[model samples]
Target: MLRRGNEGKKPLKEKIILHYDILFKSHGDDSFDTPTFWEEFFLLKAHPDYIEKKFESFVAKDLIQMKDRLNFLFEKCLEYIQCDQPVRVINALQTMSCLFRGIHSVEVGDHGFDKINLLVGFDMAETSMQVLLRCLTAGLTNDHYNTTIKAVILQLLLVIATGTDNISQNTFVEYLMTNEELYDTLLELLTDPVARSRLGNDTVLLLALMVNYRKYEGVNPFVMRLSVLDDELALSCLGSVISSAFASFNKQFVSKQEESKSSGLFSTITNMVGSMFIGDSDEQKQMIKSNEAILLALYEAIHLNRNFISVLTHSHTDATLVGTPPHTPGGTDDESVPSQPATPTPESFVDASTTRNVLSTFLQYTSVVMQDTKLKRNISSTKLCFIILTCITEDQFANSFIHDENMSFQVCIHKMPMRHRKVKAIVEKPGAPLACWLLDLTVEFIVSHMMKDLPFSQHMRCLGIIHRLMCHEKKCQIRLSYNWRELWTALINLIKFILSNESAIFGRWKKGIFALFTLVINIFNMFITFGDTFLPTPTSYDELYYEIIRLHQVFHSLENFVLRHNANPEYKDVSSRLASSMVNVLAIVRHFNPKIEQYMKDNNMASLTEEEVLEIVKSNYDDLTLKLQHSLDHFERYSERPKETHFFTELVRSISEQYRKTMVFDNIDLQDFMHF
Candidate 1:
C-alpha cells in the first residue's frame, strides 16, 4: 500500500536519492524486472509536492547530475509505451509527463542552451518520435489499449511535442500525413462526444497543432484532409467544441447573475455585499484562460484549414420561408431568389442546424465578452473573435440571419479604462432577423472605439465582416432586403461616425476610412442597381427617400473634406475614389429628389423638409469644378476588390508561406495575436 503523510518521516530529496540507490544496488542492469522499481519511482515522481515544486525548480546543473538516470528512465518510458500492459503504459505516460516538464523547465544556461543539451543528452528527439508514432499507430489501429490508456498516450505526446525541437515534430507530422488510420481516429474522437469527453481538450489541441503545420514545400496534409473528409462532420465537430467552451463561459456568467437573484431580500443583500469586496473569482479567471485556449485552437484550425468556411456553409441546406412574398423586380420572377419552406411553422423556424448553432453561440459569447470589462480589453481574445467572425461572413448561406430564437444582450462601451456607459440592452423584435441584432452589436462596438485612441485593426475586421455579408450572395442579400430599414439605419450611423470624426480620416485611421468608403460604396452601388428587385413594402419609398437624402448629405460633407485636404498627395487615390463614389450616388439622389418632393407636397408631410431639400440641391454633380470632374470618373467600376486582410493576418500568411517554402517555421513574435 502507498504510504500516507507522516508514515515515512523523511525529506523528499533524501527519499528519492535513497530509493534510487537501493533500486540500483539491488537490481543493477535488471531494474526493469522488478515491480517495486516502477511502483516506488512512479510514487516519488507522482507526489504532488515533488511534481509541482521540485520539478519546476530544477536547474540545468541538477539535471546534469542525474543525466544518466534520466536517460534510463526515458528509455524505460519508451519500452513501457509499447508494452502490452495497459496499467504499465498509463503509469509510464504519466511519469514521462512529469520528467518532460522537469526537463523543459531547465532555465540555467544561456537561453535555449539547457533545453537543447538536455534533449540531446537524453536522445529525446529521435526516441520520442519513434515512441510517439508507435503509440499512435498501436493505440488507434487496434484494441491493444482502452480509452484511458489512449488518452494518457496523447497527453504524453502533447508534452513531448510541445517540448521537443523541430525534427521530432516534423517526423511526427510527416507520419500523420499518410497515416489514414490515425487521421480517422482523431476525426472519430472529435465527432464522438463521449470519446471527446474522455480525451478532453488534448485531442483537440493535438489536431490543432498538426493543422498548424504550414509547410508549403509540398501539399499541406491537413488541408488535403479537409478536402477528403465529410464537410458536415468536420463542421459539427469543431462547432461543438467551440460551443461547449462558450457554454461553460455562459454557465459561469449566468451563475453569477443567479447569485444576485437569491431567494429573498436578505440573501440578495448578502450576495451584493460580498461582491463589493471581491474581485474576479479564481473560477472565472480559469474560465477566461480556458476560453482563450479554445479560441487559439479555433484560430489555428481556421487559419490553416482552407475549406473551413465551405464546410461551415455546407452544414446547412438552403430553405426559404412561407408568408414571405416572392422578391420580383418589375413584377417578374427573379432567379436570385433562394429556395424556401412552402409553409412556415414553429418547427420550420427551429433551424437547429450546425452552422446556425455555431453562429448563435458566437453572438452569445461576444455579448458576454463585451459586457465583462476585463474581457473587453483583452486584445488577443477580442481580435481572435473578430477574425473568426470575419471568416464566417466570407460566404453567405440560405436564411443566414433569420432565427426564431431571441438574442438580447447588453454592451458596455468604455471611453476609458475604468469609465464606461452601459448601452441599453438590445432586445430583438419577435420576428427580427439575427442580422439586425448582430448589426446593433457591431455598430455599438465600432462606436465605442470612435473616441478612444487605440489600434483600429479589429474595428477594420468588423467592417470586413459586414463587407462580405453585403456581397451579392443571393440568400443573404434577399434576407437582408427585408430588414433594409434597420440595415440602412445601422450603416448610416457608422458612416456618420466615420466621416464626422476628423481624426478618423487624417492619419492612422486614414487607411481604415478608405476601406470603409470602398465597402460603403459597394453596398450603395448594390442597392442602387438592384433596389427594384426587392419586394416593395408600404414604407419602401419613404425609407429609400430618407436614406438617399442621408447619403446625399454624408457624401457632400465627404466631398468638402476631400477638396479642403487636397494638399496631401497621399490622399490622392482615396480622394479621387471618394469623388467618383459621390458622383454615382448623387445622380441617383437627383433622380429621386423630385419624386420625394412631389410625395411630400401631395401628402402635406414634413418628411422632405426644407433643410433636406437644400442638402439634395447642393449634391448636384454640376456644382463641382471642371478640374475636379476632369480628375474624376463618371462611373465607379465594380471590379472584384481584394478582401480586406489585416496586417496581422498578412504577417501570419507570409510566415506560413515562407515556412512552407523553406520547411522551417520561423521564430516570429506574434504576442499581439496570441492570448495563450
Candidate 2:
C-alpha cells in the first residue's frame, strides 16, 4: 500500500522509490486489482509531490525534483484510460479530474502562471484535448460502457474545460471548433434526457458553465453552438436549471436540525464540530454559489438565444384548421369541389405546466426569503429573479401569465418583533389571482429594502413590470375588477409611503415616485373607460368612486413635489410622462363632472381643493413618518437582538473552564474570562 507522510516508517526517498516501483509492478500484473489500484492512484492524486503534505522541502524545489515522475504517472494514466478495461479507465478518469482541479487551484492563486507551467509542463494542454475527444468519441457512443462510465468521462471533460488554465480551455475550444463530430456528439449527450437525468447536477452545472462563459471574449464556438441548439432542448435546459436553483434554496430553507439521541459531552463536541464542518460544508456553500452561475446561464440563454425565447413564448403549434368545409361554399357535397385548405390558425401558447411551475417556485422562494431572517440578505438571487421576469414579460402573451387563474399562490408573511410586539400575520387568500400575489410581494420587497436603507435598480424593474401590465387595458381591467380592494390598497400605500419620507428620496426615488403616479393615473383612466363593464353593481361603483377621490387627493399632495422637480432636467422624462397620464385622468373626470358633483353632495364628502389637500398632507406628514419609523423599528427589534444558542454558550463555557484550569490567570484575564 502507498503511504502518506511515511506512515510505514520508511525514509522519504525510499518511500518515493518504492511507490513508483509498486505502481509499475501493478501495471505489469495481468490479474490487476482495480480497487487496490484506485487506492494507490488516489494517494498520488491527493499529493502529487512527495513533500506537499509533510512540507519537508520548499514547494518549488520539490516540484522540480518530482517533475519527471509526475510526467511518467500522467503518461500511465492516459494509457490506462485508453485501455479496454472499464474499471481501470474509470479510475484513471478520476485521477485526471483531481489533477485538473489542482491545476485550477494553482491558476486561481497568486503566481499562478509560473506554477501552472510546472504542474502541466509542455504540451499537456494538447494531451488533455486529445483525451477529451477520444473519450467522447468512444465512451459516449459505445454501448460497452454503462451510464456511470459515460458520466465519469463527461465529468473528466468538464473538469478539463472548466478547471484548467486559459491555455487548456482554449485548446479544448479550438478542438471543438475543428472537430465537428466531437462537438455534435457532446451536444447530443448533454441534450439527452435519460443521460442528463442519470448524470445529475454536475452535468447541469457543466452545461451552465459552458454557456455562461460567453461573457468573456473569444467564445464564438459556445455562442454558435447555443444558437443552433433546438428550442425545446434549450427550454428544457433552462427549466432544469431554474428548478435546480429553487431546489437549492428549498433544501436549505426546509431543513431543520434534528434532536440528538446521545447526551455525552464527547458526543456533543463531536456533533458540534460535525455540524460546523460537515453540515454546513463546502459542498453546500458551493451549491449555494452555483445558483448565481446557473441563473446567469438562463439569463444569457434568454438574451442570446432567440430560439429559446420563441419556444418560451410559443411552446407548440396546432397545424389543423378549425373549420374547413368538405366543399366550396356554393357547391354541393356530391359535387366535391376541391378548394384550397384554410390557413392554420396559430394561437400563441406556452406549456402551462411549465409556466405554473415557474410561478409557484418564485412564490415559494420569495416567501422564504421574506420570512427567514437569515435569507433576507440574498439580494443577488432576488434581483436575478426580477430581471428574468422583466425580460420574459416583454412579450404580451408571456406578460398575460400574471393573470393565470388556473393556479393560486398563497404564502404567509411572518410578523416581525416576534417576542415583544404583537403583529398579525399577513395571510394571503387561496383564491386570489396570481397577479395579486406578485404585486403584493413586489411591494413588500420594495418596502423591506427601503426600511433597511438599501435601494436597488431592481426596484425600478419592479415598477416597470407593473407599468407594462397596466399598459394593456385588458390586463388592467382584470387587475381592477378582481380583488380590486387589495390591489388599490397596495398601490396607494406604496405611493403614500414614498411621499412621506423626503429624507430617503434621491434621484431614483424621484423617478420611482413619478413613475408610480403615472401607473396609478393610467389605471384610473382605464377604470373610467371600462366603468360600465367593471362596475356593474352600485356598491362596486361607490367603491371605485371613493378610491378615485382618495387618489385625486393624493395627486393634489404630490403636485408641488412634481412642480419643484418639473424643470430639473434630471427627471424631465418621467415628469413629462406623469403629466400626460394626469391629463388622461383629467379627461375622465371631465366626462364625469356631473356624477362627481352629485356623489360628493350625496355622501357629504367635501371636495378638498389642491391647496387644502397639500395643507392636510403637510400636517399629517409627521404622523406618517412616525408610523413608517415604527414599522421599520419593529422589524429591527427582531434582527438587532443577539441570537442566543445554549449549546454554543455551554461549549464556550466548558472551553473557558478547561483553559482556566490549565493556565493560571492574573486579575485582568480572570475578569475577562468571568465576563465571557
Candidate 2 whole-model C-alpha lDDT, 0 to 1: 0.48
Task: List model 2 lDDT by residue over 9-116, tens digit each.
Answer: 845555433553443331344322355654455333222333222223224454455554445556666767777755456656665554544444432335444444
Per residue, candidate 1 scores C-alpha lDDT tens digits across 96-142 of 66666566556545444455345434346555645556676566434
- How does residue 474 of candidate 1 score in lDDT? 32
Poorly placed runs, candidate 2 (over 4 Å): 1-71, 107-124, 136-142, 164-194, 216-219, 231-241, 244-288, 305-356, 366-377, 400-437, 447-449, 472-481, 507-545, 551-553, 566-676
- Residue 580 Cα positional deviation in candidate 1, in Å, after optimal superposition: 1.5
List TM-score per model, in order.
0.67, 0.61
| Model 1: colliding residue pairs | 215-660, 216-660, 320-340, 320-341
Residue 177, model 1, lDDT:
54
